[model samples]
Target: MHVLILGGTTEGRLLAGLLDGTVRVTSSLAGRVAAPRLPAGEVRIGGFGGPEGLAAWVRRHDVDAVIDATHPFAERISFNAARAAATAHVPLLVLRRPGWVPVAGDRWHEVGSLEEAAAALDGLGDRVFLTSGRLGLAAFADRPEWFLVRSVDAPDAPMPARSELLLDRGPFTLDGERGLLARHRIDVLVTKDSGGAATAPKLTAAREAAVPVVVVRRPPVPQGVPVASTPEEAAAWARALAG
Candidate 1:
């Protein structure tokens, strides 16, 4: 049986590794990220054209199952995967890591999108620490406000007025982030609910400094799909389908 994994996150890579050699597996990456960690399996980079393209690929590749393991905030790709799997009459499973929970000391103000977060910035702070990735920087471009944007790669589009780009990867230490917050005089932080330990230290730093954070809530999961939180559970589901 051949299984296709819609992958771009750590959970996706781990799932691919867990299923290595167990079944004929292929992993698809969006190719937007630079220097992505390769999973253990056949790997294909770039878009599958959209729903129709993905559907054709599923049929042509004789795929037996699919796992939607993209980032939680990757709503469009998840929708396309759901549509393609249904069109091909193939079983699909979604692997999503649980979101982070707020602790007492954390001052989190949840928003729906980048624009909303920008709108909420008025009362918060002038110096903003932005960790919302590189794609959606345009929403904040009109703000003309001061910001310290950090990303793995340099942002493609022009940034907001008076903004400084910091090229860095996360799994950053609390002390490091604290120094950044302090040195930049950042009083507010903005981030997506892309939950995981790797980029979570900033939240802790914000908490320490009593800085308010504007967290973009995660996009809703596609409805009526089998879901698993870990590679072991996903493997079990795949094995059941194989049987």
Candidate 2:
């Protein structure tokens, strides 16, 4: 009953805790984050090469089932997991949290992709609070707006010409969110619809302050895989496979 989780998220860590003692669990992280919080059980860091390499690993390691519990915006790995699981002839489940939805009085401008979000920012505001991850800063590089870019790691070049980096991680507080918005005088916010409460306070603060938001929509999971919306539900799926 060995289960391999393609995980680097909060739900993935929680799922490892839920199944730690009951079965043989192994969590795989992408190693993008410098100091990622580890889950219980065996852990492997770095890529599995590609889908073919991942399928080979499954065969070599005798993994019984595969669970994809990656970040919502992690498009490449999700598709790779789907292909690897199918090739390995194992049960696969996609543990994806739901995307964020705008509430009443929220000025949300939703876009299909990062490029579109970047384009939408032109009409939104000049002082931008961009929380759309470090790697994506290139999309906003050519825009004239001043950006307050936040990430756990400092972003590489090709970012906005007038951007200041704010290095931080989250589970951010509402008070802090309010303070950041006020101190920076941010009139527009740009983020991905990476759902969950860890960094959701910014959206709340944006709504209260009457700031416009440009949200990049999350990419879809593979078409045929079964999807679970929570760690508990994903754990149930694993338990059924174990039984």
Candidate 3:
């Protein structure tokens, strides 16, 4: 049995680790990051042209199933995978981690998109901690709020005029997050609901500091497709197929 994983996420990597050696697994990455953490399987980096191209590749490679385990905010690729899987007549599963829900003492402003997130930041506070990744910074570029843009890579132009870039990767500690918020004097945080435990300490810090957060809600996965919320669940699906 052969499986193609459209993966650039921790969950994807975990799934690959689970299925490697048991079945043939191939993981594809978009290669937007300078250096991405590799999964434990045959890995291909770059776009497969588009949906048509992806379908062609699936047919050519004789892929039995496809699991899209990309970032939750990766809206375009998810849709493309849906189309490709349907065209190729292979089973498709989307592995999206669950979104974070606000708890007691959490001030959450949930919006549908980055543009809306920028709007939600209006009057929320300045000194914004923008962690929605580098690509979406353009939406907040013209906003008057000063931004602390933290991303794995330094963002390109069209970022906020009064923003300072902080390049860092996640699995951030709560203490570290607390210190960062204090050092930057961040009053409001703008982030996507790209949910995971490693990337969630900042939310806790924000909550502890009584800071407001503007969360850009994740786009819905393409409809009529099976969805798994964990790598374990996705691995089970793959193993079932293999059996």
Candidate 4:
């Protein structure tokens, strides 16, 4: 049995590792990062064109099932996968990590888009920790506040005029996150609702520091794909389909 894992997230990597020996898994990455942490098994980098291209690849490779395990905010790829799976007549499963919910003492301002997040930041603070990744920095370009934009890779142009770029990856620790907020004197945080334990310590630090957070809500996933919240559940569904 063969499966194509549209992978890049930690969950995708975990699922691929789990199914490596038991099932034939081909993990595909978008190659946005300079050096991504690769999943075990057959891995391919770069785009598969679009939906039509992905469908062709599925047919050519005889893929039995597909798991759309890309990042939650990666709406374009998720939509393409949905279309490609339907065109190829392959069962598709979407594995999305659940979004974070605000708890007691958590000052979270949820917005629909990056532009809205930028709006939400107005008068919030001058020193901002923008952890919303590298793609949407253009929205904050004209803002008067200073920003500390952090991402896995250095971002492209149209970033904030008064911001500093920090290249890093997570599983960030609570102590480390708190230290950054303190050292940078960050009064506000801008981030996406990219829920996972890996980068969640920042949220905790913000809560502890009483810093307001502007969270850009994740874009809706393409409908009609069966969804799973965990890699274990996704693997189970794939196993059933592959069988």
Candidate 5:
């Protein structure tokens, strides 16, 4: 069976690795990052021109099934993948990691968008640790705040007035995150609910430092798609369908 893995997350990479020897797997990356860690399979980077393009590619490649293991907050592409899979008349599965839930001792201000996050920063802090990724920095541009924006890639124009860019990858440790927060004197953290342990240490650090976190809620996944939370489960589902 041939599988198209729409991958840009840890789970996607893991699924590709798991199915590499078992099936003919082709992994597609969005190419948002300049230096993305590649999975162990045939990899294609960049967009497929939305749903129609993806559907065309699927038909051309004779893909039997598709697994969408994109970032939890990557709502647009997820929806496109669903529509594309439907258009191609193939089975589709979504492998989305669960969102983080605020617990006791956490100071979380949940917002629906980056604009709300920017607005929420008014009385929170002057120094901000912006972890909402590179795309949405424009929303925070007008806020009179000093931001330490961290992302794998540098963001574009219309950024915050007083901000320093920290180009780094994650899987950060609590010690490292704590130090960063302390050294920068970060009073507030702006982040998305892009869950998984890989980047959860920041939340711990924020809790420990008594820092208020402005979390942008994740957008809803596309409806009526089979969902898996782990690589193992996704592989099992694919195998069943392949059989």
Candidate 6:
């Protein structure tokens, strides 16, 4: 059985590693990331040229099944993958980690998109800690009075009016994030609902500091697709389907 994994998240890598050698697995990565920790399997970087290209690849590669283990905010790719898989008549599975739930004292202001979050930032705070990734920075480009943008890689394009970019990886501690927040005097936090332990410390720090957060809610999942919460579950499902 041949399997293609639309991957970039930790869960995707873990799933690919688990399925290594058991099936002919190929992991597809969006090349936007710099220095990505790749999985143990055949790796293909960059986009598949949208739904048509992806469908063609599926047919050409003889992909029997596809596992979408991308980030929850990656809705476009997820939709394209679903369309492509359907076109190619291959089974599809989505591995999405559960979203973060607001705890007590968490000053959460959920928004549908980054533009809404940008509009909400007018009276909220002066200094902002943006963790909404690189692709959507244009939404805040015009409103960038001040911002401290953090990303795994420097944005491919230019940023907003006045902004400082911090190129780093996370799994940051609450104490560290709190210290940074204090030093920067950040009053507002902006992030996507990328629920995981690695980047979750910022939310805790924001809650402790009473800083209001503008969280971009996860994009809606494609209708009628099988979903799994963990790499193991996705792998098991793929194996069963292959059998």
lDDT, each prediction: 0.91, 0.94, 0.93, 0.94, 0.93, 0.92
Model 6 CA lDDT for position 79: 100
Candidate 6 or 1, higher TM-score: 1
Pairs clashing within candidate 2: none
Show the colliding residue pairs in model 6: none
Query: How would you encode candidate 3's per-residue C-alpha lDDT over 50-148 as one tens digit per residue?
Result: 899999999999999999999998888999999999999999999999999999999999999889988887789979999989897789889998888
**lDDT (Cα, tens digit) per residue for candidate 2, span 103-151:** 9989999999889998898777899999998897888889999999999
> After superposition, which runs of candidate 5 have C-alpha atoms over 4 Å from their true positions?
none
Report the number of the highest-lDDT candidate: 2
lDDT of 5 by residue, 50-112 (tens): 999999999999999999998988888999999999999999999988899999999999999
lDDT of 6 at 228: 96
Give the 10-residue window scoring lowest on summed lDDT in candidate 6: 153-162
lDDT of 4 by residue, 1-243 (tens): 999999999999999998999999999999998899999999999999999999999999999999999999999999999999999999899999999999999999999999999989878999999998889789999999999999999998999999888989999999999999999999999999999999999999999999999998898888766899999999998877767
Report lDDT (Cα) of residue 236, candidate 3: 95
lDDT string for model 1 (112-164, tens) is: 99899889888888889999999898888888569999998889886877899
Worst 10 residues of 3 by lDDT: 117-126
Residue 41's lDDT in candidate 5: 82
Candidate 2 segments exceeding 4 Å error: none
Off by over 4 Å in 6: none
TM-score of each: 0.96, 0.99, 0.98, 0.98, 0.98, 0.96
